[model samples]
Target: MQNVTVKNRNWDIAAHMYFPEPFDQSKKYSAIVCVHPGSSVKEQTAGLYAEKLAQTGFITLAFDASFQGESGGVPRYLEDPATRVEDIRCAVDYLTTVTFVDENRIGVLGICAGGGYAANAALTERRIKVVGTVVATNAGRAFGELNPLQTLEAVSKQRTAEARGADAMITSWTPDSAEEAERAGLAEFDMLEAIDYYRTPRGSYPTSCNKLRFTSMSALITFDAFHYAERLLTQPLMVIVGDKVGAFGSYRDGFDLYNKAASSNKRIHVVHGASHYDLYDQPEATGQALEKLIPFYKENL
Candidate 1:
């Protein structure tokens, strides 16, 4: 039930800390650094998950990734896989120093796109003992050259140009603008259950820098968050996905790809009939996802 500022390498970020009712400063509680989906902030499903997890004798943190929402950074709303991964580590660093938190037992849970980034972050940051991804995505593979038509070579060339002093522009892939939603051309991409989830009053919240800078294409095209999947991650990990998601098959493949190299106990669970967004804020569905997570963290972290 508090808001604190975490200073990162880039800027000072704002985050809401939900302490369990009847707060006990004498008790060192376990914690979960809840990471939101791409283009999302603490007020969205990320906060919902953090609150639920906090209620179960765990301290949870829901934060806005840098350059988005309430967090700080210039050129706003850009998605840098490298810095986004650091945001998670920065949150963990902040958590470990806070009062009444058992830093050693702290873990993380990322929803949607955040899930993939969390997995990648855990690979290098051994400080995280237990990691969980909800409605996981292989952003790198999907956004990368996972499709032969979208060759990695083309993306790499763009990145190389940027590294050589080209302008930095990031483009947003979110459908958060009503006008943009109308033109989303859903016929082309039905992977999202509903366009409104990313647009309209249902979820869209507008801001000038809310979208990614087109220049970030350089970083994104060449940036594969799970670049080191086969190694680095040795902690207990959990992957939760909606059983009937439109992209369920892809998620399954991503899970299979990483599970092969994860050097620790791991699990994969499917929530029946729970589509992608359903796991985002659906009360019952999110509850189920957490139901699996609570036990997993209890045993692992």
Candidate 2:
């Protein structure tokens, strides 16, 4: 594995590239682009999946989204869905330039919000031969449902404030601790685990700060990850979600994608007893997901 940088529109995306053992540049190989969840960095779950996929004989890349992690962008922690979708395409742009990479065989895997971005990107980025999503969350629907009118009003106020030179606001996915989550009436099983995974030693990393620009709420609330899937998303698709991810309606998003996709080749894999956060780093759950992913990419890409 090696750390690298790819130049996007106006940012430098930091990424980790994993090469298969005994890699030979003369022989072209299929490549997979792994996208991380919102407010998360590549070094966390994205890198884990990339490394695992590389062991299965595919060159894989996990990249930090623009304005987040090690990537270059203004107003750090901005979680713009459109830019996130384009980031996947930008990664493909880099992959196509590598002599050892087979341009015709490219796949994309997205986790959490990244899954939505991957699906959106595949709608038009025809270079993506296959699309896999792990515990995918439709950002627009998920966040919008959390009091849409109120949140939109709040975002409008924040935008006005920022325009008046006020400091940008920041929001977090997890509370500082599980106790805080419980006290705040957000102590759902998946919610608590999400906090533990990203905030505790279980999966915490310096760059995975779990922060997002408050101004991003507008895009987060309006961007549909699976927009136009019924017409444009014809690539082979696989949506994986844990049965225990009911707390956040993760399975609903996966099912919606499966039901709406126009792809003739599509499958939904449910990992029993695994919650949304468990799929992030749990070995047993992640292993089950990889079992499906390995074969899907092998046959498609």
Candidate 3:
């Protein structure tokens, strides 16, 4: 494994490049770009998957989105969907430049909200041959579900504040504590578990700060991750979501992507007994997911 920087427009994307064991530089290898979840850094689940994929003999990269984690951009912690999509394209641009990468066999894998960005990126980025998403969360739809009028009004106020020279307002992407999460109505078992995962010693990291610019809400509410799936998302696609996640409407976006994609080859794999957050780092559940992903990429990429 090596730390690398990928040049993406004005930002230098900080990433971890995982090379397969017994790697042979003389032989070309397929590569997968692993995208991290929103309110997440590349050091978490994205890196986990990238490392596992590399173990399967594919060169993989897990990168921080511009303005988040270690990547460079103005307005730190801003979560702009458009820029996130562009980051994936930039990762692809970097991958194509590597001499040992098989350009024709490049693939992409995204987790959580990153799944949405990956799907969006794959729509117009034809260089990506196959795409995979785990526990996909459509950010637009998720934010839109908040009290519509109140959310919009708040975002509008924040925009005004920013224009008037006020500092960028920052907000916690997730509750900072279990009590706060519960107070915010994240009382479900899975929801509580997710809070713990991001906020506690279980999975917390210095770079995974779980904060975002309040102004980002405006763009996030308007951006659709699967904007043109019916027409432009033609590549082979795989959607993996925990079966239990469907009960909470979290998996609906994944199913929607599978249903709307024009790809002749597309499928959804439901990991049994796993919840939305369980797929983030659970060994057994993640193992099951990779079981499907490995073969899917092998057959498609």
Candidate 4:
């Protein structure tokens, strides 16, 4: 894997580019952009999928979003959905300039909320030949529990406070540890799994900050990543979801995408016994996902 930086507007997105074993720069190759879940960095699950896909003879890129991880942005840890969608497009822009990449054969794969961003971007970015999602979380809907008007009001106040020299409000996406989660009565299956994967050595990385800027929540609550998907998302699409759906609701979002997409060539795969977080890094679960993804990209891209 080669570390690289992709330019998204003014920000430099930190990324890892994975080359197929025995790679030949003289030959053109299909490329896949692997997008990480929300609150994650390129060093985590996105990087894992990129490496695995590269081993299968495809050039894959895993990138940190513009405002999070190791990427460049002001108000670090912000999670603007619109900018997240644009980040995917910027990754594609970088891929198009590579000497060995077959620009026509580029595809995208996104995990969790990143999946939602991929779908949203593909609606307008026709250069993405195909799209695949794993445990796709529609972030707008994920934040639906919060009333948008109320959240916006709170964000306005927070922004005003910051302008007046008040410190920014940083919020954690999960508890600091499993014990902490349990103590706080956050025992949901997906929540526990997330804590295990992100809050511990099993998957934690220094750059993977699990916190978000409070002002970012305003955009998240109002944004709908899958809006107009039925009409505009016409690319060849694959939606993969775990059978054991949890609070994150990626399972329902996956099915919703499959059912609503106008694409004539679309498929949905359900990984048996896998939960939302299992596909993050579990060998058996990720193996099952790639079994479907390998051929899908091979044939579609």
Candidate 5:
């Protein structure tokens, strides 16, 4: 694995590139850009998948979204949907510059909200030849399910306060830990597992602080990651989701993508009995996803 940085507009995205074991600099290889979930850094599931994919002969990259992790951006922890989508494009741009990367065979794999972002980016990024999503979560639809108008109004106020010298408002994606979730009466199976993953050493990373800028809610409430997937997302696509649906709606989102994508070749695979969070790191669940993804990328890319 090689630590790297990619230029994205004014910021530099922090990333890691995983090369095939018997890598050959003189030969071009198919490549994949692994986009991490919201509030997550490259060191988590995205990196895991990239490393695994590299082992199977594909050069892969896992990157931190701008403003989060170690990526360069101000007003840190912002989760702007548009920026996230653009970050995927920038990652692809970086891959295209690598001498060993096959430009025409580039693909993307997104986990959770990153899945939605990847789909959105591929809608216009013709350079992305294939798309794969794991436990896809459409951020707009997920956050829109809340009282979006109310949240947007609050976000407006928060942004104004921050502009006026107030401290940036921040919020966590989940309760700090399983104990906290239990105390807070959060009993959703997926939610509890998310707490266990993000707040514990099991999947936690220093750069993944779990913090999100409160003002980002405004954009997330309005951004539609699948705005024109039916018309513009024409690349071969694969959607993977766990059987256990969660409050975050990844299961639904996966099916929705499979149905809406314009790709002539598209599929949705279910990892039996796995919850959304399970696909993030559970070996059985992730292995199931890779079983499908490996062949899908090979055949498509």
Candidate 6:
């Protein structure tokens, strides 16, 4: 695993490059930029995907977003939707300069919240020739007025407070520990599935750039992803969503949105009997999911 720092539009980005162990420098391989989820790091499931994709004869990169994990920023864990989208483009921009990558054959994979960023980035960033998202999210509906629990008045107040330089203390949805689990606030959200991957040794890494900020709530509440989704029809989009998600109802809603995009080619695949997290790392499920993605990008990109 080799780590390198790259520059994004407004931030200094941290990216991990995984190439075949032989590490050939002269070959210009197709590249896939993997985007991480909200409150997560590159070493999580998205990093796993980047490594796996790299093993499949493509150069892959997984990076932490600005203000999170290993990436640079002042107000940490801030969820700026537009900035998040630019982060994906930033990865693409950085990849183009790598001699190992064939600039025109670049692809992107977004996991969980990263999926939404990848999709929105492809809307206008034509350099992203191929795109796929796993357990994708619709940032528009997940935040701002799209979140059912938040009202426009609430967003207005939050926006006003943020503009006034209010010290943002964003509340985190994930439990801090077993003790925190007992004090967990939301019922449907207190699942052990997330705990196993996030807090446990099964996936957690020390270098991961994850810092839960108190201001994330207000920042996220004002972010929406599907605002310009209809304009993405000129390119190709492939969306993969799981069959079961009791908490995330709109997990696949972004797929429906992309299908409506002005895109020339679009596809949506539902993994049978799979939960949202299952699509993240379950071997059998991910194998099936990538079988679909491999063909899609091969034919499109």
Task: Note each model's CA RMSD in angstroms.
Answer: 3.5, 0.9, 1.4, 1.1, 1.0, 3.0
Model 4, range 1-301, lDDT digits (tens) per residue?
9999899888799999999999999999999999999989998999998999999999999999988888998878899999999999999999999999999999999999999999999999999999999998899998876577888899999999999999999999899988888899988889999999999999999988788898998889888888999999999998989999788899999999888888999999999999988999999999999999999999998
lDDT score for candidate 2 against the true structure: 0.92
Quote the positional error of residue 235 for candidate 2 in Å: 0.6
Which scores greater on lDDT, model 3 or model 5? 5
Off by over 4 Å in 5: none
Candidate 6 wrongly placed segments (more than 4 Å): 21-23, 144-170, 177-185, 189-191, 207-211
- Candidate 3, residues 1-301: lDDT per residue as tens digits? 9998999777699999999999999899999999999889999999999999999999999999999889999889999999999999999999999999999999999999999999999999999999999998898988878776787798898888889998888898777887987788876665677777899888899998988888788888888998889999999999999878532355899899999999999999999899887898999999999999999999988
Per-residue lDDT tens digits for candidate 6, residues 94-142, read 8888888899999899987788788778878899988888987765556
lDDT (tens digit, per residue) of candidate 5 on 189-242: 888888889888899999999898888898898888888889999999999999
Task: Compose the digit string of candidate 1's lDDT tens values, residues 98-201.
Answer: 98989888898888778878888888888888888888666655555435435445556666787898765455565544456457653223234445565646
Per-residue lDDT, model 2, residue 228, is 98
Better of 1 and 2 by lDDT: 2
In candidate 2, clashing pairs total: 0
Model 5: worst 10 consecutive residues (lDDT sum): 178-187
Candidate 4, residue 49: lDDT: 89
What does candidate 2 score on TM? Answer: 0.98
Q: What's the TM-score of every candidate structure?
A: 0.85, 0.98, 0.97, 0.97, 0.98, 0.86
lDDT of each: 0.74, 0.92, 0.90, 0.92, 0.92, 0.75
